[model samples]
Target: MRPETKEITTESLGVLETAALLRELTAGLIASSDFDAALAQLARTSRDAIPGVSWCGVTVLRAGEPASVATSDVHRSDLDRLQYGADGPAMTAIRQREMILAEDLRRETRWPRWTRRALALGVHGVLSAPVDIDDQVIGSINLYSGRPGVLTASRQLTAMLLAEHAGLLLAAVRDRARQSELAGELDETLAGGEVIGQAIGVIMTQRRCSAQDALQVLRSASAALSLPLREVSERLVGSAARPRG
Candidate 1:
């Protein structure tokens, strides 16, 4: 049988108010240039706009390590340390790539190390969601509360929505990094085009073809084989050095 679940409804804000808040949050995120600044803004927004959440923070998985990126609470440093040590609810959610909640950390046994430490720090309840990039889990968003059962079904759904947005922002950052690498590679390739040109010349002579025709042959071969132009040029050069069979 399926586990029982609770339904939570929010009556504090009407549809229009919620829409305005989401617009403002998205605008702030777009205005920020870096992940740190955007996360800081999101933390603050969650604290002010969302109800029953005492602390809001983002944890990023870097090089297979979980680290707290930003938070609205002063104890973020401690939390970061806990997560880095792999002894926190945030890390657990990241490892499992699913939502995790502890209604009362003092009594939970699933994560003994995190539970003991969090209870000592006066964290009674916790909610965490994994941040995903193209279905690959990358990080997490953690919300902590001093009261038990603070993250109801409604609050968890809201947090999931926020986490989804955060995932998009992170994906953009990843895309930019990839684009930068590609740009650098293109610059290097253009700089080394002379070698490719020499290979093309060799092809034109050996194949008895015009210059444009040789270039098209090279391009077509590169596309058909799904190889880089540089690799194709190198192969062509190597073939020219081989003795006739």
Candidate 2:
């Protein structure tokens, strides 16, 4: 479902200013090449754009199994550790794939394991919005406040909008990561081809055989060992390079 953006209210001039800033921030994030830098910018943008939020950060699904706080102004490492330990609201929102509001950590025992720790950190309240892409929950944007009830209805709406922007940026980062992996594979393939070709040349020269004969030798070695043709080629090349003295 699309985030509800109607609850955000401000003076007309303030609203106009915020809209311009949001546009600039979103554009900057979309253009950033570094994922961590982009996430940091997003957190900063949310904290600045939304009123009453003392801290803002993101928690992303790590390997599709657990949530890890990705970025934030608050005690990011501590919160991440709690989520990684499976004892925080970030994980709860990710597991449920829904919005969560903890109005007061001191009184809330819903996440008993995490509440005491958060209260100890002086975080009075928190609002977590799940970051989902195409129905798959990938992460969340958590806004923490030292003051309780800081995430009122209006602020929650603003936070959701910020989270939606973050979700899009995260999806783009994932796509880029996949593309980088494919590019690495392609480079490996090209390097393997070159190595195999040089090995074939070595075989042909050392044995005074034709190209077809050298290929047949490689194929025979592969078949005998049930190894790949490339592996056979590599071995042949290595043997030919050893000193005969």
Candidate 3:
């Protein structure tokens, strides 16, 4: 869903200008290398692009992991307390996979603790949008304001757009990281198999031994050298693959 856009400046930006900025923002996110960088970028973007946003931060909730908060300008001690939790608007957005807003904290009864704390910190309202990094991770972008109703419909849409951009970039990074990890595992597995096979070939040719016997030889070498069998086999196979003058 496309969220509405808002201009933070005194002179509001036009629709075309806003669209261009959003395109540029997503392009930047596509190029970001890590989620941390993306989070920082999104936080900064929200603070600049959305109207009535005093503070911004990201809540990351990866499956099977603890929640973490990446604050852009939520440095106030009271605001910092919201970094980890499942009850706030940010968490609600992630859980519901939709936009959640607290127009006035004093009237908010859904999350009593968060509302009380936020009210104490001079934050009268908030807008949160789900930032799903694929199905395994849940996240949200939260916009905090000092005035009730400051995050109006337009501003909330802008914040939602920012959150979605963040989700897109984070999902890409998460997928890429997982792919790299899988590649590493595959490479290791293939290398081990190749080394063991090559060692067997060398033993068969030089020692006239069967594959099982060659494997036993490798085991013996590993025990004597205090190395893993794969390491010993890798060394043996590597030396054989090299040409000696």
lDDT of each: 0.71, 0.69, 0.73
lDDT of 1 by residue, 22-141 (tens): 776777775454556766777777667777778877777666544447788867445645543276777787888788887777678877776776777677888888888544337778
- Give the candidate number with the greatest lDDT: 3
**Model 1, runs deviating above 4 Å:** 1-21, 64-68, 82-85, 134-137, 173-245
lDDT per residue for candidate 3 within 98-156, as digits (tens), equals: 89888888888898877777887788988888876787887788888889978766665
TM-score of 3: 0.65
Ranking by lDDT: 3, 1, 2
lDDT of 2 by residue, 116-230 (tens): 7767777788888877744444777777788887765655655566667667876786677668766864564466797677777998888999877876777677779998667
Q: Report the Cα RMSD per candidate.
A: 9.8, 8.9, 9.3
Candidate 3 residues lying further than 4 Å off, grouped into runs, are 1-14, 74-84, 179-245
**What is candidate 3's local distance difference test score?**
0.73
In terms of TM-score, how similar is model 1 to the real structure? 0.61
Clashes of each: 0, 0, 0
Q: Which structure is stronger by TM-score: 1 or 2?
A: 2
Cα displacement (angstroms), candidate 1, residue 171, comes to: 2.2
